[model samples]
Structures are given as C-alpha cells and as structure tokens.
Target: MVSLGYPEERFEDVLEERRCNSDLLFSARRFAPPTYKHRCPRSPAALRRAVLDSPRLQQAIREMAGEDGDTEALRQEAQSILREMGHNQGMTVVRTFAFMLSRIFKALFRHVRVNEEGVQRVQKVVQECPIVLLPSHRSYIDFLLMSFLCYSYDLPLPVIAAGMDFQGMRLVGEMLQASGAFYMRRSFSNNPFYWAVFSEYVQAIVRNGDAPLEFFLEGTRSRSNKSLSPKLGLLSIVMEPLLRAQVFDALLVPVSISYERILEENLYARELVGVPKPKESTSGLLKAHRILQNDYGSVFVYFHPPMSLKSFISGRLDITPFSMTPRHMALRLSDTLRVLVHHLAHSVVLRQQHGMVVTPWSLLTTLLLQAPSDHLFPTSCNSEGGVHLPDLLHDVRCLRTVITKIGAMQDWPDAQSHEAVVLSTLAMNSSLVTLTKEGRVLLNVDKVDRPKCRDDILNRACTVLTCAAYRNHILHLFVRPAFVAMAQRHAGSVEDGPTFSHFCFLVQLFSEEFIFEPGSERKDYEEGLSLLQRCSSLLYPLDSQHHPSTITTNFSVFLGQIFQPFCCSYQMVCNYLLTLEHGSMQKESQLLASLQEFALQQLLEGRSTELEILAINVYKNAVASLSRLGALRRERRKDGVWFLTTSQLHHVADAVASLKPPSQLPAKL
Candidate 1:
C-alpha cells in the first residue's frame, strides 16, 4: 500500500527509507514458523508460571477475525485458519500478524542501495531458504541500512534480532514488529530461561525456512573503518539448532557497508576509552539534528557471496562450546568478513561504487595533504626511496583504483570540469585559507570556472606547508622519537597478530575518518597513572637500540597519540610544554627529567633507555607541532634525506617552554 500521509522532502527521504525495509521482505529468506504461535511475548516458562497471557492477545486475534471463540475453540479455529491458508503457521493474528503489516508499512519509510552484486547473488541464495547476512556494524543506522539495502536489492526481508533494552518503546516496538523484527533481551544471555526460548524460536525459523533470521556478526559497530571481532553469542542460535538437528546446510552471507564519515565515531570512541556517553540531552540532540540535516556524506555497500554453514559442518567444523569455540569461529569469520568490510570502506573512500562528485572541501583537503612535504620545505629528502605525494590526477586516471586511498586519491574533473566542480564545491562548503604567492584565492572561489593557473600551484604549495607544520608536530611529539623507538623493540613480534585486523583497527584510526576527543582526559589518567606508565613501556619498541623509521613505527606513534588524551597519566599530549631539567645537563638530561617525572612515586629504580624513548618522543611531538603548524609529518630535506629536528635539539627556549605539561609527565610512557 502507498503511504497515506503528507509527504515533503524530509518525509520523502524517510518514506524512501521505509520502502527500502519493505523491499527486503520481498527477497529475504523465509524460515519456518514455530510449531506453536504463543500469541504473547512471555516465555513458556513464564507462562507456565502465570495465567493466560495469551488470552487477551488471543481474543484480540479472534476479534480481528470476527469471532469470540473459547481458548480451545480458538486453538481449533486457529487450526482451521491455518488449514485454510496452507502457509499459515498458526492463527496469525493481525496483532500477532503485525510482522506482515510492518513490512508493508516499511515500504513507506526507507531507502536502500543494493548494487548489482547485492541483487543477483542475494536473490539466488535467499529465495528458497533462510540465510543470515552478516555485515559489519559501524553505525546505529546499520540495521536500517541492512534492511533497506536488502529490500532495494530485491532480497528477502529478514527478521532481525534486535536488543530489548528499549522494549515497550511504543514507536520502536511497533516499528520492529512491522519490519518482521522481534526482541532478544540485551541481557538475556545471562538469563538462561529466556535464552532458551529466544534460541528455540530462532531455530524454528531457520529449521522451517519460514523467515531468514539476521544478526550482525560483530555484535557491535567498529569505531574505525575496519570490521570488528565477531561476538558469537547470537550466531550460537543458528548453530545450536543445526547441531541438534544434525542439519547445517544454511549459507551465511557477509554484507558490508561504509559511510563517508560515521557520525558516531566520537561518541563510540569516548565510550571505548571508558568515558560516559549519556544520550545527548534534548537540547543537544536538537542541535545535532540540525547539523545532520546539512551533512552531505556518501554511503556505499557490498553484498558478498554466501558461505554455507552446511559446508563447514560437513567439513567437520566444530560448533560445540568446548569443541567449537567462539574465538575460533570469530577468527575464521572475521577473516572472511574483513575482506568485505575493507572493500566497502575502500569503495566509499574512492567513490567508486557511487559516482563521485569532488567538492571543494575534498579537493582542497587532498591538495593540502597530498602536496609533497619536500616541496613545502625544499630541502628534506632521503637518499633512499623518497616519500611520494599521490599525483593530484591519478585516480581520475584509473577507474579500478580503490577508494580507501582517498587521503591522496585525485579524481579531479578534466581541466574544464575540475575547475568548475572545485570552485562550485568550495563556494558551497569548502573552507581553507592559505597564505600564498599569488595573493589568496578563496579556495572555494578560486575553484570556480577560472582556468587552472599558477595560483592553484602557489596556494597548494602554501597550504601544503601549513598542513605539514601540524603533521610535523605529531611526528616530533608522539611519533618520531618515542613510538619509533618502541617499534624497534617489538619489530620481531610484529608479525604475530593478524595483519588484516591490525590494518583495520590501528592503522585506520589515524585516517581522516576519526579524531581524538579532547574532552576530560586528565581525570581518567590521574586514577590510573600506573597503567599509563606500564602501557608506555609495553607499547614502545622491544629494546633500546635498533629501531628503524618505518610506517609501522609511524603507525604505533599514531596509535599511542590517539590513545593519549584518554591515556590519563601519559604526558605525551599536545597540552604539555618542555621545561628545564631537574638538576644538570648531561647526555639525555632533558629526557631523563621527563622519565623521572613519568616514573615518579611509582618506579623503584633508575630509568632505562626504553623509558627515555618514551620521554623523548613526547618532546619530539611538541617540537614537531611547534614548528609545522600542528601536523605530524616528520620534516626531511628536499634532497630526500631525513633529519632529526627534535625539540630537544632546537634552541627555541620559548617554544619548548610551551610544551611543558600543566602537570608532570606522570612517570608513564
């Protein structure tokens, strides 16, 4: 049925979103109905304890059918109705039949994108039986995205297992049932009785192949663009029944999604770091709504080929708690889903899935960061292989180039269009101010229909310099000396963890998609000062001597810095300034002073070279920031030779003074 309400642009989007949900039902796997339709939300155990919880609901169901039958009569009458509609599981009450109605209603309020990949592949696997589409969780909106995307792609409408914390939420409750959704207690795993019922019901669906049951494999959204480790609790439902029935032919489809920028990154990061994130206050929520209304983020998704559960079982894949472990399953599934998530994240970054229209902000951001740092300073190049700033037009040149390289991808419009799109996007929303040779062309305005000129070159060069200034700061303080030294220690063990998982989480955090929340971090650290110190030592290189400057070292530094604000006791923050040594000026005197403070009241003996690395990296970070306008790219000569412009070496007393922490470097890394 068409929507029967007033429709406007805002509602148009909302309605489209709803329709997207409806579309899923058309194509989703239909699991078999439970043998008995309880007609109530209460558990059988609970019902065994109570009077008829279903009486009222059953009455409502019968009333909907134009009759007032006794409970037994009702059961028998339900049988007739079931017999009438051969597909009916039980007397499907419109009230209990809410799942059907909701699907139709959803047709009015959703939007989706199921590229050709989603359509063809999903249709084949989902048409005859129930299948789980395990996708990465990165947004609260992920569930909505999955439902809508499936619908748009003409895939089956899945009955999603949603958390029950907000049960009785009139709007939410109605919405869930309407979309063929049911509740699973957020805390029910601990409540064995409820767990059994939920599990059994899910099994019935999968076993009967009435409706496909879907669960997010990760259990939670990933803070970075990477896929998270799967929480196997929910998947246990599908497996338990399969194990019991000795039936395991179902396919597990991995669906992946990526957003231009996750609106919840800051929110989720704070929580992960143990900071509280109460729902925004009403006023704050309203303000956020206004901001969201104006955001122009591109969204992307991919539907991967299905992995058959039966294949695993037949292959002797263990599913028992003892024999088959969640960690083991997670490791394997994570490996499978990680590839899909990477592709999705990459696709969004590159705008390959959806045709990309370069805005002034993106164009300018690319120019600023992608400018060769050497050109900005003119004297910093290494004799070995030099750093290469991606060509401004390379992506525009290669159709197959992935999107995750967006920080440097150049998909400029042809000379003519590039100039126009850049100018237009700038005027619309681009905002970068640079001091340059040809005076200042407002980045947004300069991007206009004007022909590309020497001005583009001048402005980019200067903009590059400014960004470099900040990147250099990051290197000097957190990266260059500190993490680089720490990486040296662990260089041998680096290959132990899954390389892909590391890339997904640690490496991705430094990308533009996330930023550290500079909120009340000091308070947290003060409580766990020792933890920070221990972590600093643990995170730094394995040993003192042989650290090399590699991307991995740079990556470690970035990770340390990202965790710094919340690291509490760690003084490797941008807030601190350098200071005079406690007593003398000998070899590593300043470094020693910093370490002494970090180890203050906690350590029993003298500091080691490892601790010194920690202190020096912080000092270098401050120095780098002080010099490079606050960026973290290390400064090198235009000759491709690297240089150590550490703050300790620089004689800028005033600038060094700015980096001293308000408090001492809490004897931590």
Candidate 2:
C-alpha cells in the first residue's frame, strides 16, 4: 500500500465482487443455471474455440504484446494445435527424465533426503479413482519433479497446465504437450471464459482417465518464499462438471515441494527489494536456461493424504464451495509447504541471527563477512584481532537449535555429513575474494553473497511483512487506493536496472573491508559506518525521534565511513541521495520501514526470538491463507490500493488489530 509504483493487486475484494455480482447471479434466464448433471462436454472442440475467443485471453495478450499482437488469431491457432495434439504418450518419458534429473541434482548437492511419505495413500487413491495432483507451486522445476515422481513410482503421468509465456520455442511447446502440459495465458484471471475453458479441460481430464491433472493450487511462486493464494478460478470452473456427472469421487492429492539453496531465490529476493523489473527478453530467458543448466538445488516432494468429493455427491457430507470443497487438500498442502519453507530457512539458508549458537565455521564466516562495510571477515574473534566485535559463537547458538529442529524432520537425512553439505551449500558463493594468501582467518567474503550486506534481518523482516501480524499492525489502518485513483497508475518494474543493482553492488563493494587483510587499521565499527553510509543512499530516514538502539551513532560518523575514497563502489548511495534531494523517495523507503515496524512488533509480542522468527515458516503460511481469502472479495483504499474483499474487510480489520491465535478464527461451519 506504499506509494511505490506497483500494481495494487487486491485479490480478496475482487473475489467478493465477482461472487456477489447480482447481475451474474440473476443470469439464469439468459444462460440458465447449470444443469445438475454433466455429460461428455459437447464436441469439446467447440468449447475450445469458445475459450480461444474469451475476453481474458484478449486482455492478457494485450498486457504484454499490446492491442495489435494478433491476440485473437493466436488464441485460435493455439487452440487448434491443442485440440489436434490433445492426448500425448510421452508424458511417461518426460516424467522419468525429470525425476532422474532431480534425484541426480539432490545427490550432487548432497542435500537432505527426499522421503515420500503417504506413499500408500497416493497409490491407493490413484488405484481407486481419478486424481488431481494439487501441489504447492515453487519454481519452474516443480512441473517436472511432480510428473517424474508420479510416473516413476508407477502412477500415471500427470498433465500440467503451465503459463503460456514460459512455453518458449515451438519445440518446447511440443515437448510440454507430449509431457501432458497445456498452456495458459499468465494473466488471465480476470477474463471469465478462458478460465471456464481451461477448467472444463481439466474437468475432461479428470472425468475420464485421459490424464490425471497436476496443479499448483497456490497460483504462483510465493513472493514471501512460501505458499501463495490458491487461485480458485480453475477450481470454480471444475465444480459444475463434477457436480453434474456425480463423478464426485475424484481425488485431490496435496503435494508439497521443498528446496535446499534454490539458485533463483537470490534473484527473486532482489526483485522483492526494489530492482527494475526485467522484460521477457531473449537474454533473460537465456539466463534462466543457464541457471536451469546448473541444476544446483535439491527438490523434495511429500504427498499428503488425498481427499475425495464423492461422499458429498452421495448426500453423505455437506459441501460448501468455499469451506469443505478442498479443505483437506488445502490444509495438507499448506502444512507441507510450510515445512519445506522452514527446512530451507533454518537448515539451508546461510545467514546469522541474534543468539544463533552455530558452529565456529558458521559464526566465523558470518562475523567475518557480516561487517556492513568491510568486504572481509575479521581475522579472528579476539580483542587482539582489532575491534571488539561481539562474541559471535555465543550469539549463534539459538540459530543452531533452529537448524537442529529443521533437521529433525522425517525427510532430513539421518546423517551428519549431509547436514554439513546442506549448510555449506547455503553459504556457497561462486566468486571468491580473499585478502590473505592462505585464505584463512579473515578477509573478503564469498564473492556471490557480497551483492549486498542486504541486512539479513531486514530481508527476513520484509519477507514477513506479508504476515497477518504485520498487516494488522502496519497496513490495517492504511487502506489501499483504487487502481485508477493511484497517483501513478500501473506499476513500475523493480526487477532490473542499475537503480537498485547499484545499491547491492555498493553493499558488496564495502564488504571488502570486513577482511581488510591483517595489517589494515580499519576498525570494525568504522567499516560498518562506512558501509552504512554507502548503503544509506538506498534507504531513507523516518521518525528521527524514535530512532532504535540498533542505530547507536550520529549521522555524521555514518557519512564519513561511507564516502572515504577506499570505499568500494562507483560512489556512495548516501551522497547520491542527498545530492538528488528527491523528497518523494519515502515511497522507495517502505520495505525498511515495514521491516522496522515488523521487527519492533515481534519483539514486543514476545512470540519468537529473532532467529526463531527467521527459521519459522508460520509467517509465510498465514500470508498465503489470508491472500487467498483476500483475493475472493473486493475493496479499495483511498490511495487506489486494492484491499481485502469488502466481505473480508472484517478479517483484515481483525488480523490488523492483533496477531490472533488459530483458535481465534471463527467457526467455518
């Protein structure tokens, strides 16, 4: 809801409005309420054409390619190809390769083991009835991993509905088709009909055993590094068909995927912090291809127990489209995703927290590299080493405990070496900058992670800002503005460009001083102030009177450390900010403010210590739940920001008021 130039995509309010549209609700005379029973979709090919002509398809194409991008013609052609190439046999082959590749990467990374729990449930259900594999969506690799795991274990291959934007070359499209993937326009949630077509197609797949379907119930990659709202557009569409044929028995398998040290996570994190958005250019895709080629991460999938809707159709259990429709499916999906997130944060991601109680290596590496300005790690953690930094090893003890809790999971390898590998991978950086010939004691950090001191605490705080706790605290009273009313309508790209990258580069540039080699006379505090000064350009001040103890020095000292000639950077950001005098930069300042508000609240709330907060996935899971609820209603703020659906207005108002316990939620029944 900050004035930053980004789309105010309020999902909840939209869902509410769409649901309560009195006109549509009363349209029975025109199209008639759907009949209770479904038949084989009439000439399904005709339905495909209707889908091609849907408004959503036209709108999504216009979003990226402009009004004259041959939207209609392309849709028609796409559908023609889909119809002609409908059922594919190679789903098995692609799935096999995908699983083999994933397993290969896991071994190469020496990651925690992948133990498929609830294996019998998945197999038994698949044997009894058709299934829809609704997994929590994570990365691009999610598609292949799910398919491979299914077929490799003797289950039939699953058809995935992937974004058309990712289809790439014709061959890739063909490959996906053969792998049982159907293309969907990336931004088609708004247009009703295409969703209808896509829904029906999935319905067809499930109604018959043409292909069991796979879905990332959460719509997209979790921005907060957890699950996202399960976009219900498809779910709504599939309902009528299921209701009609009373094939109410189809099972929904909840799949969860966890990763250890995802390569693209840093890129996603960068985008979150305010980089210029990148376009889908050839170079970008090529970059994605290169990352995929590395295959440097682990993939773990757990199949939660399946839920069948058959009992409801037989008049045994009550079903409200919202509450019980996919209750079991959603819960298990949410829980599994949450576990995956925590596993990565505590056991894999390389960073430090207050009271982290880690091994000497983790503490040493963090302390040496953590100096805000100094690129190097201090030579040793002693007064004799110069600069009396805090006792890092003691500080990190709590962090180690979180890791231990993470490792306690059933899927974690029951071996210590694997644990070490998982931790090392989290700390790995492609580039090495060493100040010492022996590369010991202190000096330059792993080149890759130096992109920014990036304030590890701040990053976690920002990611958690989506939490109900933060939303209730910071965003509750500050309502969003309407899209059309926004000061600068539409969003600006923050995924690319020198604007933000320069900031990261400066963080990295200053990190060099952390290791300052043995003889360098730079004090740790001095190095910090310098780095702070260089980094401050990327930040702005707020409520000067309420400055937290975390910042214990005067502004001038900070300035000196940043601008000194030895500082690494094209130039310090603080200098640039003061020079530009862009007063409106406060909008660019929200994440930090958001983080400050969140961190302070968490401290006051006494829920979890900082390291425990960093390691937990609860924040992300709550955000996903609320986001899903938010998307189903309509509401807007005075500043043109979209808010929770008016119906869910109370939910936000309540959550904003306090971080209520799960028991605080009202009874659904």
Candidate 3:
C-alpha cells in the first residue's frame, strides 16, 4: 500500500448497512451541524428575503435603473430570477427520495465503498465551520450518491448547484428542488439583474451558513471520464465571502467518486462519437430502470479532508482591497487573485485524481491498448489479434505491480486470488469484451446493434472508445511520464534543455486535454523526469555542466506510446485545418462535423488506425489549443461566426505531426 501522507482507513460498504437496517435510515438522529448551532439558520423564505434586501442586489437594481429609472421593475425582475434559482428543500422530500434511492442502489451495485476515516474527518471539521462539497462529476448518480452519503452520516444536506436543464423535467424537477437542488442558468453574464440575484443568493448562503453548499468544479459531467478544466465562476462566488470578511472561514471538501462501471458508459461513448445525448426527462428517468437489471460492480467515494479557505488565501493574496471595497460594489478580480483561484481549483482536481481508486478493469484496459503486439509481451495475442486469456492475466499482474509501485491505489480484493479478481472483473464488463470458447478475449462490438455502415470501423470504434474510457481512469498516473518519454523521442536526444523544452511544448499544446496546475510546468517536468529516472529509463548527466542525460532502457518507448492516440487525433485536426481555405470562416459546429466525417473517412481508408480520433471532445480540445496558439482566429461578427485560419496553422500542424510516432514502432524499441 502507498502512503498518502494522511490517515488511511478501511472502506466500509455503506449499502450493506442500509440493507441490514432499513429502518435506521428513517429513524436515525441526524446530527445538527455546527453552522446551524453557531448561528440561527435562515429558512428558505428568509434566505430569499435576505438576498432580495441585500445591499448588492439593491445597488445593482438602482444602478441598472438609474436614479430616476424604474427601480421597482428591476427589483421585480431580480425577484423573478431568484424564484427560478432558489431551492425549497424539505426534510420530508429528502427522506422520501433517500428511501427510493436506497432500493435502486442496492439493486444496481454489489457494493458502495466509502472511506470511514474521510467521513469522520468531515464530521469533525464540519462542526468548526461551514463546508463546501466539491465532487467530481462522472454521471448523474454523483450528486445523488453524495446526498445519500451525507444523509447516511447525518451530515448537513448540501444545497446543490444544478443546471437549468434539470429545472425543466416535470414533476421530477420539483422533487429535485425539494431535495435541495437549486437550478441556475448555464450562463447569466448577459443579464445583469440575474447575475446580481444569483451572486447575492449564493453569497447569502455562505455568509449565513444555512447549509453546506455543493457544486461540481468541472461545471458539467465529463463524457470522456477524465477531469475537465475547473470552472472558476461558481468557485469565485463562494470564495467572495471569505475575501470580503463576510464569513470567518469555510472548509472546501474535495470528494472523489470512482465507479467500477459507469451507468452512462455506452451513452458517453456514443455521444463522444457525435451521437446526441438523450434529454433528461421524467420519461427518460423511468426508462433508466432497465439499468438495475445489470450489475455494476462497485463504487468508491473518498472525501478528502477539508481545506481551509482562510489558510488557502492567507499568504497568497492581499485581500485588503476586497475588505476596503463596499460589499455592495462590484469588485473585479485582480490578475493575482484570478491566478490564485485557478491554482486552488487545479489543486482540488489533483486531490480528486489522487484519491481515485483504480479498478482492475482500468489496468487491464490500459495494458490491452498499450500492449497490442507480442514484442511488448510475448504470447500476449493470438493469430486473430485477440488477447489470450492466460497472457492477459500475466500482463495484468505485471501492470498492477508497476502501477501500484508508482503509487496508484488499486481496489483489488484481498479475499480473491489475482486470477479470480481478473476473471470476475472481465465478466462484469462483458459488454465491452468477451471470452470465447477458444480462450481468447475479444472486443464485443456485436453486442450493440448499430446501423449497417460502409465498413465495421464505426462499430469497432464504439468498443475501442469504451475501453479507452476505462484506460483513462489511471491515465493521471502516467501522463507526466508519458510526456517526458514522448518529448525525449521528439527531441531525438536526452539533453536536459532540449527535452525539457519539448516537454513544455507538449504540455502547452495539450493544456486543454489534461489538467496541469497553473504555472507549474517546470515542477511537472521535474516530476516526469524523476519518474523516468525511477524506472531506470533515463540516466542523469555524469558531468552536470557539459554532459547530457541518456536513455538507458526501453521503458521510455513503452511510456511514449501511451499518448499515441492523442497525438494522432491532434495531428488529424491540424491536417484538416491545412485543407481549409485560407482566411475562410467556418462555423465551429460545421467544422467539428466535417472533422468527424474526415476522421471516419480516414479510418475507412486505413489512413488512421486510432479509434480515439473519432471522439468529438478530442477535436474540441484540439480547436481550443490551436485557437490559443493563434493558428485559428475567431471572427467577431454580428452573426456569431466561426474561426478563421491563419498561415500559422501550417506551423502548428507541422509541430503536431513531428510528435506523432511512425505508423508503427517496434514494441521493444
């Protein structure tokens, strides 16, 4: 076991408790949180009144209407917005839903593992101050699971920030509202009145400590099963109270929820390949009951110890300006404060990634993608390109050892043998892969019926993308080292300066693709370098002044191939840009569709074998990177036009192409 430098505890199956004593869920004495005791908590109605009467909203109304303008009209508009955004949490409703979810969860998952120590940590810290729950968003089940966990522990039920999409779901919407979900428009910057009311309402909750506030820092569900860059808007709103000294201190808890099998696995994969996501509705919600028929192995929820908002900002920021400014006045975040927020957000994501529990399936998928040929692992594949069962078990064992040694937390059970654990996991995910009578594991593309296309490529892509999602679970552990490996190959030498420069370039180019703490490229480089050195892949310079480092092992080649799909996808995007007319404006939606079609064509023609290139998220990130590099210029037109390509596009394309490995590399290099 790797030490996390904090107290570790055995995971308890929370659902098992629910199963044994269903009555306890209803009869248990819910602990009154310290926030409620320290101050008289505001009722939902009182909170709304406070937000309306707050100095900030009043000033905003007056300013927007002017001295002689109709202030009442703006106030009415603000009231309307508040009505749309506020939550009406009722204990009766919470209990009702909790009971229902208990049954659903019991039917769906074999186990729900929660870190007892983490829960106890929250129980203790919550008594000292208000808390903000930040959970990683992978599926709709995330918020529900969080609330259920909180209810199980008798902790305060957080008032969750939900998107307006949930607000339109008929009776289910009202039930969600009663269960403590407050909806907000996805974007409100264009509406001054709405922004004022929303900000004040959020600040009021923090200032009053009414309930622990909760929100997804990623802003939305990650269809790719990876961390999205943190959204700073809601985070900034919550921190404003501390900055202005409206609240003494608050705790930010980063919760990491890892699923053995995501409920939306197929949906996410299809959506990534240009299939539209089904709308959230009561009918759709009822239709989802079919999921309970299948068994999702387990879920692990790790609540990191609470971080102090005061301590986070103490030495880093000078909050005097915020203190001096009137509470009612709008204060722009200084460049320094913005950077601090960015770092804090990134830090939370890093913590979540660290706390994630890697499943055996994750390691298995990683090996399957990385070890496609026998040269990497002899006898790993059969004549038909399928993985041999025994060889897969051997590879999985080796990978598990390497990954665990590198500090990844694996959820392999102690009660079962390694072979049993591997076989069980494979059976659980049979939809993605299947074992044939011949003792070979093959991708089960035929399981999902699709329209007959020109070729079987798209059908094959569905399975590859799903497998890729599982592989992405443990990617954080390898990304930095993989970058170092790729950089060394591209630089064609192990010189510290050139390799480090290339590493920095790759990090910047793929900034949108991975989460790197802001302004920490140099630190990341050192980390990647250290990991490679640990693997004995790179040797330190003997003469520090004149000599350069050297690659001493083939491990570097193995590491470099981890990002081959990404490099291939990014290069394809650049190549498509090269085909576009110079200075021609292209709508982003049209461009993405065209790119998807182009990728499909390339696949059919065998020009590109990387199935990951079909994902729209990859293309989206590629567009973002190119735009940041000034290769694609956004045309500011009244019609809200698309990007304009510049000559710099060619240079960007060449750079990406240079990083992509040859069509095939020797498995042993």
- Scored by lDDT, the top model is 3
Candidate 1, superposed: residue stretches over 4 Å from native: 1-113, 246-248, 265-275, 280-292, 318-669
Candidate 3, residue 3: lDDT = 30
Off by over 4 Å in 3: 1-7, 23-37, 371-383, 447-455, 536-553, 662-669
**For residues 125-216, could you state the per-residue lDDT of candidate 1 as single tens digits?**
56544576666566666666666554444455566766553335545455455565566655554544344334445655666555556777
Best by TM-score: 3
What's model 2's overall lDDT? 0.38
Off by over 4 Å in 2: 1-113, 276-297, 311-669
Model 1 TM-score, all chains together: 0.43
Write one digit per residue (lDDT tens) for candidate 2, span 342-386: 322221111111111122232233223222222232333321221
Q: How many residue-pair clashes does candidate 2 contain?
A: 56
Candidate 2 residue 109 Cα shift, in angstroms, is 4.2
Ranking by TM-score: 3, 2, 1
Better of 1 and 3 by lDDT: 3
